[model samples]
Target chain A: MVEAWQWVTKHPDKLAGWTLEHIWIVSVAIAIAVVLGVALGIYISRPGKEHIADSVLYLAEIMMTVPSLALFGLLMLILGTIGLKVIGFLPAVIALVIYGQLPILRNTYIAIREVDPAMIEAGKGMGMSERQLLFKVKLPLAVPIIMAGLRNAIVLLIGITAIAAIIGAGGLGVPIFRGLRNARMDLIIIGGVSVSILALVVDGLMGRVERWVTPRGLKRR
Target chain B: MIRLDQVTKIYPDGTEAVNEVSLEVGEGELCVLLGPSGCGKTTTMKVINRIIPITKGKIYIDGTDTTKIDEDELRRNIGYAIQEIGLFPHMTVGQNIQVVPALKGWPKDKRSERAEELLELVGMNSAEFMNKYPSELSGGQRQRVGVARALGADPPILLMDEPFGAIDPITRVRLQDEFLKIEQEIKKTIIFVTHDIYEAIKMGDKIALMNEGRLVQYDTPSNLLFKPKNEFVEQFVGADRALKGLQLIRVKELMTGTPPLAKADERVVTVQARMEREGVDCLAVVDNEGKFLGWVDRVNVGKGETVRDIINRSVATATANAVLSEALSLMLSSGFKTLAIVDGINKLEGVLSFDAIQLALSEVAQRRGSE
Candidate 1:
């Protein structure tokens, strides 16, 4: 561990680059997941669309059950077939976005669906159109819960991004893979610790964001 | 005025919530839709604003067919409140009250001014409560905000479904009285729904009593009490309806206009002689200006030199505008069969007696029987 610390200090620029790469890839994937997941959640959670919601949630659950490495391999094959880059950042991001779907999608769907029914009734009775009801009432109340899902997805994707190192996507995962190849326990500990720290910090920030976005009326007195 | 010409609502599952109910509510009149649970009073109200689409029949608001108006446009023009209050938790009290006006594109300053005015109209302190959330308010306060929100755009018609139903009984009565006062000032045509017969009696100018999705009786509260249309109407109004009818008639309506009066400076013997001549046990004592002083009973008349010295100053008194039930309760509680009615400045108006209440009840019963 001491030697790994020394090596990290000796190669500060390399460490910084890898950490930034890890953040860049995970951020991109989560950004895409948030937009796509929220839109799909809203579309499927509409009244009379329960069957569609169920089917979409089922598919997301199946995607969640697949091992990250195996999913990446499958993505590689699909990308190769389509003549796109099958390794590095492309497969890494594609795989992370897939893994991020379950939490983001499910949370968005549940949050919107579970908004107080009385609020919707009041909005409609007050002459709010469907679009206004969604944008003003339902979505605002759903923010905290949806943010919880986003936080969960971010943490889960950060940890999963480690496996992207196996396919040559440079990130915090690089040191752990190298440590494993060279049978270096300290290097593996360093990589594992950095990933854990990154997840914790991001989650803490998201917690602040969740509280900030929540309406004052919803906060505990 | 609003008219429902055989309005019917049959849910897709074949439940007949409202079955061809026809009624008319005059402009600025408060009409109460009253019934037990599952009796379709709420369904009847919702159909007017098209919240629940009618399966058949037509509804006209101010002589315009409701179907001819767009649903959102129609709802915007009709104020709606419900039992749950249904205030948006995400919005402040001010924002909630500004909902309808904001939707109609009122300018910001106008919307806010309207909100403050409405909050005051509902007896809430606008400056203190405008920025507060619904959760921060008591149930009664929330109901007040709900009403202010309903009256947001000041639409000519208001629909309220048991707006005070969720409050504690004591607060409920106070809210009912306050709302009635507000109603008098605004005079918006209103369709109020309630299962409480007393609320219907207190708040409605006309009551449309329903049973099993059919209109059993649509009449004044007095008629519902004294002249029920059928057995169901009789039972729904309850067994003690004659007593309840006391709530409908004012003290002045039943009090004798020319009650015998004894002057405060008159000699006791002279007052006693007057009471004896009138064949009455008591005479209301008044000063030279006709301001009520008290009463001088025959027993007390001879006990003092003048009516002033013999006057029972602590006798219970009621305002002329007070309902008979209030007067009767005061009389009963004070152990007096006769009650003095006075105006705002203690001026003698009339007198109420137990005999007069009995006569009123018997007259109603006889009239109903003859019909």
Candidate 2:
């Protein structure tokens, strides 16, 4: 613990770089996950898709069961020299994207389903088209929860990102794997602290954003 | 005008929410669908706009089949407001009001201008609130914004689902009063859904009582109160409730002033003499053309000043369709017992009082029991 504390204090600039790399992975993953996951979640949540949700859930479960290492290895094997050249960032990103999708999709589906029926009815009563109801009323209200899931997923991704160091992803994961290899406790602490700080940072920022989007008091206007 | 012929809504779960209900609302009339929650009042409303597909039936808006219009095109032409006041939290009041107009692809300036106008119409007054976010508003303010957002496009028809249900009683009464006044001026065909009987009576030009997914009774507010078709309608409308009928009686017949009026130049002493001769407690002060100027109390006028000089200025002269809840509140707040009712042109219509309400409710109740 002292060693980790000393590393964070002594090499704050290096820690900052490590933190940036950690954040890079999280933000990229979140951006992609937000777009794709939310869109997919909305599509699956739409009416007449009860069966499709089952299929998607099954597929995601299968993906979740795949070893993160094995999944990246497979990407590496496919990319060959190309994989080694980009420092294997693609493999890490793909793996995190796969793992990050579940919470987002689930939250989005539940949020859309859970929106007060009266609101949707009001939209329809006023002659709102399905698209309008979904976009204008349902989706906006659903944003807070969807963002919650995204936050959880991104924070979770920060921890999982350390595993991507195996694929040579340029992040604090570098120090982690290097420390593990050389049996250097100081490098490991630096890596772990950097990753944790990244997670806290992402979670905190997203939390603020969620409050801004959803607002707290009823008299927000 | 809206006409629903044999409209039925059957959820995929084989549950029927609205069962072969047929109803009609005339143009320039306000209609309320009054029922307990889950009584299909909401489902029936959704079916009109095709939000939920109808299992069977046809819906006509302005006499045109609703199914024939493009869903987006049709919805863009209709305004919707709900009790939760679903103004997008991410949107400013102006942006929230601009959604429909933007969807309709109206020019940017026209849409923004329209939103401003609607904000004013709903009493939010855009100049003060257009830039505000939904989160910054109180319940009543949010509701006003919701109404303004709905009215942004000025559609011929509006659908409101318990729009004022979430506000505090005081704010609710204020919003309800303003809504009634706006409706009088706009006269758009409107379908309103609410569980509050008082709200239904006050807002609906015609109220449709629904029970178990079926429309039990549909008629004018006074007619429904006077002649409920069944025990269900009567029960739903509530029995032994405090004078529901009083809210329905038009204010025109209740004012007790015996045709006392004063010209712009009429002296205080002259008006007092006229009041004494008529034995009237109040005088309807009007301009030369007989427009509703304001109200003056005969008992409170000072002998030393003109009738106008000493007359108590009050918050009356609202449209005759205003509810007793509002009238009573204004009276109580202003420490006055009565308010002058006005017509569309601000002409003297009648006066409203708590005793007058009781008398009207009693008469209607007696009449209903006899019927």
Q: How much does candidate 2 score in TM-score?
A: 0.74
In candidate 2, what fraction of native interface contacts survive? 0.40
- Interface CA RMSD of each prediction in angstroms: 1.0, 3.7
Local error of candidate 2 at residue B336 (angstroms): 7.0
Writing each residue's lDDT as its tens digit, candidate 2 over A133-195 gives 898788887877888898888888888888888887878888888899999998987788777
Give the DockQ (C-alpha) for candidate 1: 0.53
Q: Interface root mean square deviation for model 1, in Å?
A: 1.0
Tell me how each candidate scores on DockQ against the true complex: 0.53, 0.28
Docking class of 1: medium
Worst 10 residues of 2 chain B by lDDT: B249-258
As a whole number from 0 to 100, the lDDT of residue A207 in candidate 1 is 91
| DockQ winner | 1
Please give the lDDT score at residue A79 for candidate 1.
98
Off by over 4 Å in 1: B250-371
